[model samples]
Target: MSVEAIVNDVKTRADVVVTRGQEALEVGVKTLKTANGIVVEGVQELVQTNVSAGKELSTLVQASVTKAKTDGLKAVASNPVAYLPEGKATVLGAYSESLKIVSKTGDELAKTLKSGVETISAKIQGQAPVVAKARKTATKTVAKAKKATKKAASA
Candidate 1:
């Protein structure tokens, strides 16, 4: 082949290489941006869920305390019989019920928080395979594009 023909061929190949490199760089940047976006969305969901759980827990705790207080007052309120020797059992029973109320509410709050965390974790896990598949597809497409461009340049 003539020197000029060889030089032109080399120039064409170089141009193809440069174009493929640019495409790969752009794909890399886009993949990173997409992954970061997904992560940010997942984190936002987690934060929102946690906030909701906290509010519900606060409300439950308040209601439980209020009920305990109201019931205790009612049990001993303005009753001479309540303070008499026969009223000790009544007072102790009210206190026991009050403790049971607090314990049950505390257990419920723990379950709520646990359920919230598990839901968030499940959502995060759910997004993973999708992102992985997207990345895999992108990688395959980039590879195919590179191969086609190189073949066209050679021809």
Candidate 2:
């Protein structure tokens, strides 16, 4: 081929490489944005779960305290000494119920985290093939350019 034709071919190849590079860059940016959205969603879910748990715990404690107070008052009207064992049992029951609430909260948090991780991983994995294909195309374009240059020089 003439020098002019060779130069044109090389230029076309370079353009293809640049276009592919841009496509790869765009895909990376999109992936990053998607990941950021997932993180935000995850955080929101965690906050909501924690708030719900807090409300439940607070309500339970309040109810338990109110009951204990009422019972104590009744005992005082009768015999205060008889109230001690019942008070201890009530406190222990409250503690046990509180532990159950905390355990449920922990479970909810773990599920949220797991869901976030799975979503992020799926997004990244989905983009992998597109990025790899772009890289491969870029590499092939470079190799072709090199070969064309060598042929032109020898000509």
Which candidate number maximizes lDDT?
Answer: 2
Count of clashing pairs, candidate 1: 0
lDDT of 2 by residue, 1-155 (tens): 89999999999988866765665566555445444443444344444445545666666667666656888776556875543333444455555655654554454444434444444444444433423443344334334534644554455
Query: What is model 1's C-alpha RMSD?
Result: 20.7
Provide the lDDT at 92 for model 1: 57
Q: Listing every candidate in turn, what is its Cα RMSD in Å to the true structure after a full C-alpha superposition?
A: 20.7, 20.8
Measured against the true structure, the TM-scores of the candidates, in listed sequence, are 0.40, 0.41
Q: State each candidate's clash count.
A: 0, 0
Which parts of model 2 have CA positions greater than 4 angstroms off?
1-10, 73-155
Candidate 1, residues 1-155, lDDT tens digits: the string is: 99999999999988866765555455445555444443343344344434544555566557656655666766656553433333344445545655654454344334433433443343433332223343554345445534644554455
